[model samples]
Target: MKFISWNVNGFRALQRKMDVFAWLQETGADAFCIQETKLHQDQVQFDTPGYFQYWNDAVRKGYSGTAIVTKNEPLNVTYGMGIEEHDQEGRLITLEYENYFLITVYTPNAKRDLTRLGYRLEWGAAFTKYIKGLDQIKPVIFCGDLNVAHQEIDLTYPKNNNGNSGFTQQERDDFTTLLDNGFVDSYRSLYPEQTGAYSWWSFQFNARQRNIGWRIDYFVTSERLKRKIVDARILRDVIGSDHCPVELELSEYYGRHAGR
Candidate 1:
């Protein structure tokens, strides 16, 4: 199955800039997830041909949000992490398919100079705990703009960005702890030493033109689903938002594993 994820920056903005429906049809994706929608349900229409859509809009409209558009309906769907404090932003959504739990998350950004680092650190810990809790039940297929570059190789100006919000030591360490808990970065699993593979570019200083960006968007799956990974891709050619779409092609069937 082909599953894809992209941080559209803003749902309405992207819809205006490009034909999102056309692109989805071209990809033939079974499931499509998006982040940073920056819209509430009232501001937009949730219609897309051949797809059942689900959304988690932030309590604060025109801010962070997430959505899942799938060809097949889920057995069950969940919004946020079930923690009131974290649920306010609508940053997470989980779709329980027959064999796996597909989680789409938009992790909180640490902000410039780590101003929000404290809260983000707490979020990282809680988020990791949350994922581990899911891992215990079934191998997971999770993706989104996690907002952190886990290693030096993940961004262009790594040395200069060492202590920056997205590349900070604390944030990186927390992400490492998440991987340590059994999630594997699916793209890196196939292209281990590949470079210049980025998903999010800055709107500042010609970052996109120079390809100076971070590989923050990801398709991370539990180790148990390792063999199901057929391919992972970065859709740099597609355009609309500063972020690009990342995809994962898996062999795991909907009901063969932990499907409901």
Candidate 2:
């Protein structure tokens, strides 16, 4: 099975520039998850013929949001973490399949000067607890723009960027706690020594052109599903937003070890 995750940055803006449906078809993914949609259900209209679309739109218009377009319908779909404090921005969506739970999250970004850093950390703790609960029931496949670099190798000039919003010590430690709780960072697990493999780039100073980017987007699976992951990749060539898509391919029909 194939799955792809991308942070469109702004769904409407991307649609105006390129054919999203055509691109989605070309990938032939069983599921495609997106973050930073920046749209509410009423703000835009998009459809995929064979896919079941699920959306979690922020209460605040033109802000953070998430969605999943999957060919396979989920048994259940959940929006947000169920905490009143955390659900307002519509940052998470959980789709429960027969074998596993698929979660797409748009983690809160710590604003410039670390203004939102405290809230970001709180959200991380709540998110970790939520995913851990799912892990107990079944292995989970979670992906999206987590908004943190996690390590020095994850971004260009990490030394200079250290303590910045996305590379802060607090954020990285929170990410560590999540991984310690039985999840595998799929891409890093596959290419631990690989560098310049980034998914999100800044629009400033021609950052994307220079490949000065951060590997903040991710596909993390329960450690038990490690063997089933055939490939995890950064799709740097495909473009519409500042971030490109990331992909994961799993062995076919591994039902027993697959979904929930």
Candidate 3:
């Protein structure tokens, strides 16, 4: 099964910037998870004839949100972590499949001024616990804009971003704790020594052209699902939003890619 995850920045805006439907048609993925949609469901006008769409919109308009467009309908679908305070923004949506759970999350960003850093840390810890609980039931494939670049190599200008939101010690450590707990970051697991492969880039200083970016987006699966992971990719070239897509292809019986 091929599962692709992207923080599309804003799905509504990208519709005009690029053809979202055509992009989806070419990927041939079982499911597409997106974050930072910045739009309420009523605002989106997508009509992918075969896909079942699920939207988790934030209570605050034009802010945080997420989505999952899948070819097959999930057995059960859930929104948010059930933690009322954090659920208000519609930052999570988990689709339960027979073999696994697919969670699309848009982690809270620690503002540029670092004003939201404390809340972000709390959210991370809660989210970590939330996923671990799901892992107890079955394997889980979680992805989206995690907002933190775990290592120096994960981002450009690590030294300069050391104290910054995405690279701060606390954020990185939280991610480390997650891996230490059991999940495998599929992209890094497949290409441990690779570099300059990023998913999100700065809109400033012509960063994308220079290839200066941070790989905050990810496809993290339970360690038990590692061998089933056939391939993982960072689709840096197919850009519509500031963030590009990251895909994970699994040997089939999982979905449309099921007959291999």
Candidate 4:
């Protein structure tokens, strides 16, 4: 099975900039999970013929939102973590297939001033619990913009950016905690020591041109699915938003017939 996850920044903006449907056809992924859609469902009229679409729009118009377009229809679709406070932003969506649960999440940012750090941490803990619960039932594959660089190796200049919103010790520790709870970061699992591979770049100071970026986007799965991960790639060359798409290819053997 193949999947592509991207923080498109904004779906409408991306569509206006390029042919999104053509791009989707070009990728040929079984599923395309998107974050930061920044629009309500009715606002956009995107027609993807071969894919089923699921969208979770934020209460606030043109703000935080998520969507998934998939060639295979899920057995069930769930929006949010069942927590009202955290659900308002439409930051999460879970699709249940015959074998596993796939989730797309847009983790809240700590903000430039770190004002939302406390709330971000709170959300992190709640998110951890939510995914863990799903893991207990079946292996989970979750991907999207996690909004934090997990370690010093994840970003361009760790020392220089230390304590910043996405690089803070607390935020990083929270990510570690999530991985510690029976999950694996698929890309790191594949390329443990690989460097200069990134998913998101700053729009300022020619960061993308200089390749000064962070691997805040990811495809994470239950530890049991680690071996099935055929390839996890950061498609740095693909451009539409400040963030690029991360692709994950799983062994075809682990499809519907794969037992829990």
Alpha-carbon local distance difference test for all models: 0.90, 0.92, 0.90, 0.95
TM-score winner between 2 and 3, please give it.
2
| Residues 1-260, model 3: lDDT tens digits | 88899888888888888888778888888899989999899987899899999999999999989999999889999999999988999899999987789999999999888999999999999999999999998889999999999999998789988989888999999999998879999999999889998998889998999999999999999998888889999998987878889999987755433213
* Model 1 lDDT tens row, 113-165: 67889989888788899889988987788999999998888999999988998
Off by over 4 Å in 2: 255-260
Give one digit per residue, the lDDT tens place, for model 4 in 37-63: 999999999999979999999999999
* Candidate of highest lDDT: 4
> Number of clashing pairs, model 1?
3
Candidate 3, clashing residue pairs? Answer: 253-258
Candidate 1 Cα lDDT to native: 0.90
- TM-score for every candidate vs. truth? 0.96, 0.97, 0.96, 0.98
RMSD of each: 1.6, 1.3, 2.0, 0.8
Pitting candidate 2 against candidate 3, the one with the higher lDDT is: 2
Model 2 earns a TM-score of 0.97
What overall lDDT, based on C-alpha atoms, would model 2 receive against the true structure? 0.92
